[model samples]
Target: MVARERIITTVRPLDENRIRGSFINCSKGEARRLTLPRLTEIDWSEVDFLGWRDPKAAHNAYLVTPRGGEVIGVALRAAEKHRSAVKQSMCAFCGTIHAATDVTLFAARRAGAAGRLGNTVGTYACADLACGLYLRGKRRPAVHNPVDRAPLEQRIERTLDNLARFLDEVTTDNAR
Candidate 1:
């Protein structure tokens, strides 16, 4: 049997220009206005994607990741209401089981015509958008329950695969 390729779950450092240029759903002006995270302070080796909630606009969030050697960014809108702390929810990307309060529903407008038509896709993700850290053990979730008992490399691959599917949904022009 052919061996499956291992996925590298790290992103190269990104500058402001590159990050702004990577956005697909938002207009140039919107992208320009979007606040960026402090690039220099981030340890790129620890992250599979760069994600942050917009400081200037609390409900807005952004995710930038490398797909097939190309960097792509998505603008996400976080739901105003958060899940209750009493419940438990899992991150769709990293598979971490978090206190329900830690998971947020984020919607991304599809690229191109669909987005212009007001079409959006949503997913349940970590409120902080720090899936990479949780997956790599850099950060721990509030709850200690583990969902997937796979090896670290395999978990990384699963996370990236989940992200790829989400990206495809957002970038594909189903409106055509």
Candidate 2:
């Protein structure tokens, strides 16, 4: 097994250029034809990381390095589950609110050898996108989502940029 060090990366709000570039690059063939979701609809604050579900496989979304948008890593978002937990639950992607029972967790993995060959790992997220709600302040107890998708040239660029920001945060945190 290749020994890898866990790097603490910071999360920042994605800029317009990065978002637009990612949309352009990731949209390949039908993905391009598909109507892109509104950026405003995406809850940016609660987004722990940008991820993608593999093109060949739809089961997993892998945490990607914002730099080069490479599937260099993976992560998961889990809801704090307890019998005495809060009453209102939120979805990670859409920022919708629902009862705790209405929420489910989803898991995804990054595509390519880097992900499958053990260089990286898969992650889990809320099945209903409660994290989205937390980011947008639509719900309480902010949640996160695990996202993954096929390799896109532009997405890779966005991933690189995102990763850089995350790394910077980690470095800063370590110093503190």
Candidate 3:
């Protein structure tokens, strides 16, 4: 397991607008469906990274990486909350929506010295992107078109890559 510390810098306050914009731009068309919670509502002093679901696609979450008070990348997430007695997790990437037993979470971890030396956090999502439905106008497989699948996958992949780059940038900056 990796241990990460929340970011706590009194001199540099997080730019809420910048972070929101980064998340919005990274989301592209999905931005229209997302709503960012107020920055003031979050404990910035204790947050190394912040993430939430798209307002439109509440099940689809995103994580933002902060470096030098600027947000660099956004990672997409898929999670599900159950309504039964026991809480369960679902994959956002795959179409298989199941109980916790069937779902697995995948997260990206910070690597290198910055990860090992600084406050580094990991991003997690469903191994399968079932949660993508929230973005595709809540269209389930029964009503989904084959054409929509490819583009959504591409977007999710791009989001993940962007997050990796952000982690790399953080590592590089910390090294300097």
- Top TM-score hit: 1
Best by lDDT: 1
Quote the lDDT for 158 in model 3. 44
Tens-place lDDT per residue, model 1, 1-176, is: 22233334678888999999999999999999999999999988778889999988999999998776778899999998844546888899988989888889999999999999999999999999998789878889898875566888788788888888888788877786
Residue ranges of candidate 1 with Cα displaced over 4 Å? 1-8, 82-86
lDDT of 3 by residue, 1-176 (tens): 22232232221345556655654223345443456666666554433345555566544555565544555544444435344564444333333334554444433323345444443443334333333333344433332233535565454454444444445443342433
Please, what is the whole-model Cα lDDT of each candidate in the order they appear? 0.87, 0.38, 0.44
lDDT of 2 at 121: 25
CA lDDT for candidate 1: 0.87
For lDDT, candidate 1 versus 2, the one ahead is: 1
Over 33-150, each residue of candidate 2 has an lDDT whose tens digit, in order, gives 3332344665554554554344443332234334333223333323344574765554433334555555545432223333243232222234433343333345554334333343
Which has the better lDDT: candidate 1, or candidate 3? 1
Model 2 regions lying over 4 Å from their true place? 2-27, 33-35, 41-43, 50-101, 105-110, 113-124, 132-138, 141-176
Sort by lDDT, best first.
1, 3, 2
TM-scores for every predicted model: 0.91, 0.33, 0.38
Ranking under TM-score, best-scoring first?
Answer: 1, 3, 2
lDDT of 2: 0.38
